[model samples]
Target: MTVERVEFENTFAVLLEDILAELPTFNIPSEGAAWVKECLEYTVPGGKMNRGLSVVDTLRSLRGEHATITPDELHKARVLGWCVEWLQAFFLVADDIMDNSKTRRGMPCWYRREKVGNIAINDAFILESCIYRLLKKYFRQDDYYVDLLDLFHETTYQTELGQLIDLLTAPEDDIDLNRFSIEKHRWIVTYKTAFYSFYLPVALAMIMNGEKREAAFTQARNILIPLGVYFQVQDDYLDCFGDPEVIGKIGTDIEDNKCSWLIVQALDRASAEQRQVLHAHYGRRSAEDVEKIKQIYCDLDLSAVYHAYEEKSYAELCALIDQADANLVPAGVFTKFVAKVYKRNK
Candidate 1:
């Protein structure tokens, strides 16, 4: 690991302690407190930490690489970064249940663990509430505290709205190719994944740095939204083509009736016979049905299509970053993000 990554991981223990230390104030029984601690530990820290780490990375880029960040500033950045992770954990717990997912981060979904079952739903809520609790404890006195609150709340709402759009667009009971389109796919990813995953961390860093101008945010959004859309499209592609062990989860987008990028692209280019095959087998639970859909994706050359989209997206993002107003936010802030995600495998 890089020195910066080591530093980032070391801080996680301190923050976890800070969070658990406050559980007593909630007047929970000892067992309850322990359970909450376990839930947080299990759900929050195991991922690649890209989204959480981006907050610190953005802060560094905003301040210049050689500039020294105060210890307090570093701690606050870590806290905000974890808040983003917490927000993600909140969404994933509920999402796993909704999607009936089997695994995450190479482990069984929290909701599927013994004794955790449906109760993971409530655990998801607790995960979300912790974001505000951390905000109130650590950032409450900062001048931009309310902006931080507004940012998290608005991002959460956008993600939930995106989830709603996705669920409605691809309801398992209904299989209609007409309902799947590139436009609808874009909307689902833009709201569901882009805001929280791409936009929120940098926005948090900008707010902490006291750069609250509307124009700066607008400029950031234009680039980050598309960056996020590209990330989710990669996710959809990986779900179909990626190695399950490497990705740490079984791909279910096809069988779950998800309105995935591949599906929409296939719908857009499919012949009538191919469309009929998809409509029959797209959401079925049978392995044979899934293979049929995979065969169709192969025949359609989706792998090549995705690669082409990946290239175009990288070029477009680079162009946007080059065109951005550096007086508002440094181009490196955006460039570093693109570098991290472009052509990523997991």
Candidate 2:
């Protein structure tokens, strides 16, 4: 890792210590506190941390290169960044349960770990509650405290709604491609992944930097949401085409009956007979059936189609950034985000 990344990771350890130090105020017993600590260690800091680190990066971008960030200010930004990470952990814990996932970040899903099981449902809630707790502790006296709370709350609701759409559209027992579409895929990606993954971190940074203009937020959302959608589309593509060892988990989108981007694209381009083949094997858990679906995806040349879409989306994002108003928020904020995930493998 680079020196800066090492420093950022060191701060993560500090923040975790700070969070655990305060658990006694909640009157929890020692064992419960230790469990929470273990849970936080396992869930909060394990990912690539792009979402968490983006808050600090965005703040720096908004402030410009020459601006000075006080140590306290930098610490607060890191805390807010981890709050975003906490929110993600909360969602993923529950999502893994709902998706019946086996692994995450290459480790066994928390719910699948011995003794975690269904208690992970409540653990997810605890992960969410920690976001507010950290917010209140760190930002309660700031003018934007309410804004932070509202932003997190709204993002959570939007994500949950998106998850609902996904679950309703692609229930494991129900294998109906009729329910999948480009529009639905976009909706699911936008709400479930885009808002939290892309918009929330930058929005938090903007708010912290005191950019309260609604138009500024509107502009950021217009760019960042699409950017997020593109990132997720890449994720969908990678789940099928990228190496599981590289991406950190096995691709279960097909076997799990996910309304994935590849599936929708295949449906869009499938022949009548190919459609029959997909409908036959798309959601089956059997290895043979899964291979059948993969064969169909390969036959349909979804990989080339994905590459085409990737190029188009990247160009559109660049155009949007080029046209963004520099006065409201620096174009570089969006540019940095775009660069991070443009052709990401994980």
Candidate 3:
């Protein structure tokens, strides 16, 4: 890892310690608090922390190159970064149960742990509650505290709505291709993945910096929500085409009946016979059937199609960033995110 990445990891460890140290103040018994700490360690830190790290990145960019950020500022940045990650952990713990997922970050999901079955649901709630505790602890006196709280609540609701649409789109027992569309794909990606993943961290940074004007957030969201959609599209493409070793998870969108960009595009281009082929093999677990569906994708040239969409999306994002109101939020904030995500393989 680079020096900066190591620093992020080390700082993140400190943030966890700080959070753990505060747990006992909740008046819970020591045993219960210990389990919650273990749960937080297991769920919060494992993923590639791009969303969380982006908060710090934005803070630095906002502070500019010559200005030395103080220790207090760095601590606040890390707190917000981990807050985003903790919110994500809240969602994932419940989502794994909803999706019946077997593994996450190459280990059995928290929900799948022995003796942890239905209790993981409550644990997910606890994880979410901890966000407020942290915010209250660190930010209660800040002028933007209410804004931060409202932002998180609104983002959480948006994500839940997106998840609902996704579940309705591809319910386990119901495999209706008609439910899939480009519009629906956009909606699902925008709400479920984009809001929290793209907008929240940067928005948190902006609020942290006391940029309370609605126009700043409007400009950020305009660039960010679409960037988030494009990111999810890449994710959908990667789920099928990326190296499992590199991506760190086996692709199961095809098997799981996901409303993936590839599938939506395939449906758009497919003939009646091709559609029938999909109907036969779209959601099967058999290796042969999965291969058959993948064969259809290859024949449809979805890879080339994805490349074309990616290029167009990248150009559009560049234009938006180029046109961003640097006086308000700075173009560099959006540019930083685009640079990290665009054309990324994992």
Q: Choose the strongest candidate by lDDT.
A: 1
RMSD of each: 0.9, 1.0, 1.6
Report the C-alpha lDDT of model 2 over 1-346, residue by residue, as the tens digit.
Answer: 8664566788778877777889888899998888888888898887898988899999999888999999888889989889999999999999999989888999999999899899899999999998887888899999999999999999999999999999999999877889999999999999999999999999999999998799999999999999999999999989888998898888899998999999999999999999999999998899999899899899999888988998999999999999989999899899889889977898
Compared with the true structure, the alpha-carbon lDDT of candidate 2 equals: 0.91
Cα distance off (Å), candidate 1, residue 52: 0.6
- Give the CA lDDT, 0 to 100, for residue 217 in model 2: 97
In terms of TM-score, which candidate is stronger, 1 or 3? 1
- Comparing 2 with 3 on TM-score, the higher-scoring candidate is 2
Q: Write out the backbone clash pairs for model 1.
A: none
Which stretches of model 1 miss by more than 4 angstroms? Answer: none
Q: Compared to the true structure, candidate 3 yields what TM-score?
A: 0.95
Alpha-carbon local distance difference test for all models: 0.93, 0.91, 0.89
TM-score ranking, best first: 1, 2, 3
Model 2 regions lying over 4 Å from their true place:
none
lDDT, candidate 2, at 201: 97
TM-scores for all predictions: 0.98, 0.98, 0.95
Candidate 1 structure quality by residue, lDDT tens digits, 181-268: 9999999999999999999999999999989699999999999999999999999999999999888999999999999999999988
Q: Evaluate model 2: give its TM-score.
A: 0.98
Candidate 2 positional error at 249, Å: 0.5
Give the clashing pairs for model 3: none
Highest-TM-score candidate = 1
